[model samples]
Target: MSLAVALALGTALALPAVAFADADDSDNLMRKKRFGQNTGTVTTNSNTGGHSQESGSKATTETAVISDGAITPFITADGAAAMQAVADKYAAVVAQGGWPKVPSGKLKKGSTGKGPAALNKRLFMEGYLRAEATEGEYAQVFTSATEDALRRFQRNHGLSVTGVIDGPTLGALNVPADRRLATIKANIPRLAEYSKDIGNRYIVVNIPAQQIEAVNDGKVYSLHNAIVGRPSRPTPVVMTPLTVIRFNPYWNAPASIVEKDIVPRMTSSGASKVMRDMNMKIFNGVGGPEIDPDSVNWRRAVVDNYHFRQEPGGSNAMATAKIEFNSPFGIYLHDTPEPHLFHTGSRFYSSGCVRVDKVAILIDWILQGQDGINSSRIAELAETKERLDKPVTNSPQLRVAYLTSWPTRDGVAAFRSDVYQLDGTGFVVGQPLPVGETQGGKRYVLKPIPRSLEAVDADEAVGFASIFRRSSDRIDASERLPGASSKSTDSLVSLKDPKAKLKAQGRDTGKKKSKAASNGKTRAWTGNRERSASEVMSMPDADGTTAKKPGSKKVASKKAKSGDKSKTAKAKADEKAKTTKSTKVVKKDKTEVAAKKPDAKAVTDKKKALTDATKTASADSKSATQKSNTAKAAKPADCKAGADGKLPAGCKPAAAAKKPPAKPEKTAATPAKTASSTN
Candidate 1:
């Protein structure tokens, strides 16, 4: 048997065992008819009037059980062959009047009404049920088989897996057969386009399905739930090789985000608060200087021509890991902080990039051959907050494609909403028509998956972590220890005490010094916040340099004090030389003033007169020791004060004691020793 027939027979195999009831259970609604009357048995030769053509044949009619076990990868050659067969089946379905619509009302097991009859007929026409299952029983009765078949239909069509029939389930059921066939026709060319030379190992991202299949050895090795681009910013079709895996990546904000996102937020709230809270930094340009956001003049203009970057941490848009690939659209795959979105059935919530669920698995698969990258090593990297990057030598191929109808390993063609409206086929999320009816020009609106607008990160790094030397990005490499005070302690640093951090901050030696310097300038970052006025006394900047505030005094080194004493002898010699030089300068100035009389004569005469007066005043000033000695000599020994307020001991009146002939002026030409006066 061919692969298609073998696959289709799985549906037929489920047919023979469905016995309606023995009238044993009292609560079963299937016991509506009496047991004695034989309605009739359906066999290969039995003839009964049926609603559809498949109802006539017993063995040839077989439907694809879409929710069956896994099948071949969607991009492989055999998978394409499966799709071709499924398309043929759909075309045959379109040739006939198509399957009947399952009525839109809640129906579970034991439900008996017109709704169940319509549902059973619909399931039977698609080969979900054989004629034997409902044989010799009331046709309107809802059987356990109907619920199971409805679930298969839901899974194939990408609807929520609620087994009972409701609005959404019925909506999928009532879609026109011609429209479904059209969806298959549109994507056949696309499938054929990628059918050849797809490597043995590759990754396929089905955008409409919002699921990723990692095909290894032509089979799915791992499956991941994914969030792709939205309707407005649909993910593009691309074939590229994963080139780089960045651990703890810094998200460089693209220009679109800088204009549409960053600018609007800065306009509403204060720019400073938004940047600091979001842990984002602004750059002068792509691969240019990292500018502090506080330095930007926000009021003067709109946000333009600047590179915005989100620092690596839990707050980053691309949390933890980012996988880089080369594409013209600047698209790549990365892990996200929003892990909860994967739970929803319709997950289309990215700009143009793909966000993978459980991305560590994908990373481990991509880096399989590279050294030091296994499950344990990847976990360590995921927990780390430092940014580190390395090239991927054993990268896998990645293909992102869009399809509204896909044939799975189960041999059934599952359908999805035309989210991007690429196929332009008719498929609605809710019931398109009233019960047991058909219509034309039915409108099917594509609704967006409900998720908040996320702040977008740059698809490509602006080359900041290596070249820009941003302070926030400096943790690119530090021989990262788990934490402080272990055997790995490289410095005497303490978390509570910053002084130790300060001491180690400027000690960029060994490998760091050579790496940070080029052409005699240092561009090494210290990975610390910008130093403030209080921290200026100790902390270093990105250049490994620190500056003291202007006008602040610095304590002189002890060596300078010891040198001053040794220089005392030199000081005396220097004083003598200065005296000689000054006398010559005064004589030359006197001569020049005599020659040129433009206020020079008055200035010279005043200078000379002032010098002479200063000399005379210094000579006349008596020494404090001499004054004390003179007073002692004049006073009589054992002198006592008289009641008459007169000088009793000296036996002379205060008026009669001559004031010792006012001490004669000392030498007028000598200058004072301690206080020097210059003319």
Candidate 2:
């Protein structure tokens, strides 16, 4: 018995996961999700056996409890009708003043609030709770039932299903009822467009949700996660028929990619390197003449309208198969080598095509009715890397749409992030600048400081002239005015006048002193004034000019006797002579400065020219390179930090944000149709 049980368990582990279909259509709440829900166990298979089918609401089992994980195709007539009803209910809720804001804090199992008797009505009022909570007042107490309800709410909003309250949950729960109603109504038109001409068996690639749905007979047959085009290079919405399946396909570069991407890269990385890395060959036209990559100018190629064809292999962009369709947008479903991006919450990274995660399994499902094409044969062909094409005889009608809000079949509305800012909902996913462009910045050259000599020389000369003038005045007052009884000095005693000589003869000096004293008499003086040694030294020095002192005071008793001239007479002569010499020296400096003026001017002009050249070079570098400012503390509101305190991806500088969007990729002309269709 033990051996038998071990064998059965091993078989269960090895066997591929098969879809467990529900008996009743309404109990669609699934315990697992296969279409990239943030939570829940995802089971994927490459087998051709069956697919998972569960989509409707957050709760649906017999117990009518909220079941967290479920996969549902988003766009359909039934979903549209269901959402219209959802819109009405929301309008009524808005009219009645909407739901209460959930208390902001940690709320999980075992948490407590007011008792259950008063009716814990927080999430219930927001259409989250189907039945009454058994816990505290107004469902304020965190319990298992409350946790499940919270997870369902989070999942429906395209958020990670962490049972406790988070930044995103509070934001969604508190959205005004009127706004929510408006968002629903705004999305109704797109849903209505999807509803028309959609047959019972069809395929949907909802761009906002980033998930692909294969529906048959009004039910979800399988769901696969998908990566769609970015907002800048948005995937076009279209309705077409899945025509042919091309395996081991060659990827022809679109005109937009050639001009916007490959050409620009070739400018920096050389044409040969890019061609070798991408495994591409340049052709004169689609199937015209072959040209060597080294001989072709990549930029000129874009103008000449040359084509780029990537060979088929592991490095090929289309890994396994290509689902051909009829459209002008040049967008179709294909497989990718970088499958890890399928798990990303925002899978808006492609140029224009839809990249399916489990593409082989989907192909196997679509090719079932065709002869000689099966899972085993697909593996065989992929191993050999052989090119092949099979027509899809009963191919399902395909649609690519952008629906941010849709109601599941059971009336519980599910929402997706408005990645493209469609639905008129103000919310959008951002694309930040590359880290190398902002964080790991380029270095800029520093310009040198300028120094001019002309201004400095002129200022020094003027300063020296002023000093000499002040010194001369002080010396003159001390020598020439000391003998006067009032403020007046001798009429001929001018320090600035070269004509004033201090020589005085015997009788003339006496007559002059007596006459000047009599005429200048206003204030009274007692005795002959004398100069102290300290006063002589305290006067400001002229550096290169004369400093004169008063004559030694004569003895009062030994007044001027017979021909011995008074000592003051001799001192006056020396001062007048020195002042004249200093004035002459100043005039000589003025002449010398004037002679050097041209040289100083030339030095200043050269300095200015060097500075201007340096500034011009700095400006050129700024234009050529994308430099970063590491000192910025605040960010633009469009690229603000998130919960992790880091900038969201796709945030560029304000100058970069104004640039026009990426060019749309051109579609290849539809390949000629064929017969002998496959599954």
Candidate 2: regions farther than 4 A off: 1-71, 114-120, 134-138, 425-679
Which lDDT value does model 2 have at 78? Answer: 65
Provide the lowest-lDDT 10-residue window in model 1: 46-55
- Model 1 agreement with the true structure over 1-679: per-residue lDDT tens digits: 5322332233222211111100011111111221111112112110111000111112111112112124446577665667788888877877988988776678988899787888888777665776755555757888878777776776666555556876767777888878888888777766765554567778888777777767777766666667777664566665556778888777776554554445545644556777776677777766678776655544223344566677777466667788776544456777776665566556666666788777877777788847877767777766656667868886778877766666765456777677766564433121112111122333221221111222111111212233434333322111111221111223445535665554457543232333323212222222211223333333334344555543222223233433553365455455456654653333225633343333456456656765776755555554645787898798777555567655554555335654543333434334332112222
TM-score of each: 0.52, 0.53
The window of 10 residues in a row where model 2 has the poorest summed lDDT is: 670-679
Error of 1 at 202 (Å): 1.6
lDDT of 2 at 216: 66
CA displacement after TM-score superposition, residue 555 of candidate 2 (Å): 85
What shift in Å separates residue 529 of candidate 1 from its native position after superposition?
Answer: 31
The candidate that wins on lDDT is 1
lDDT of 2 at 396: 79
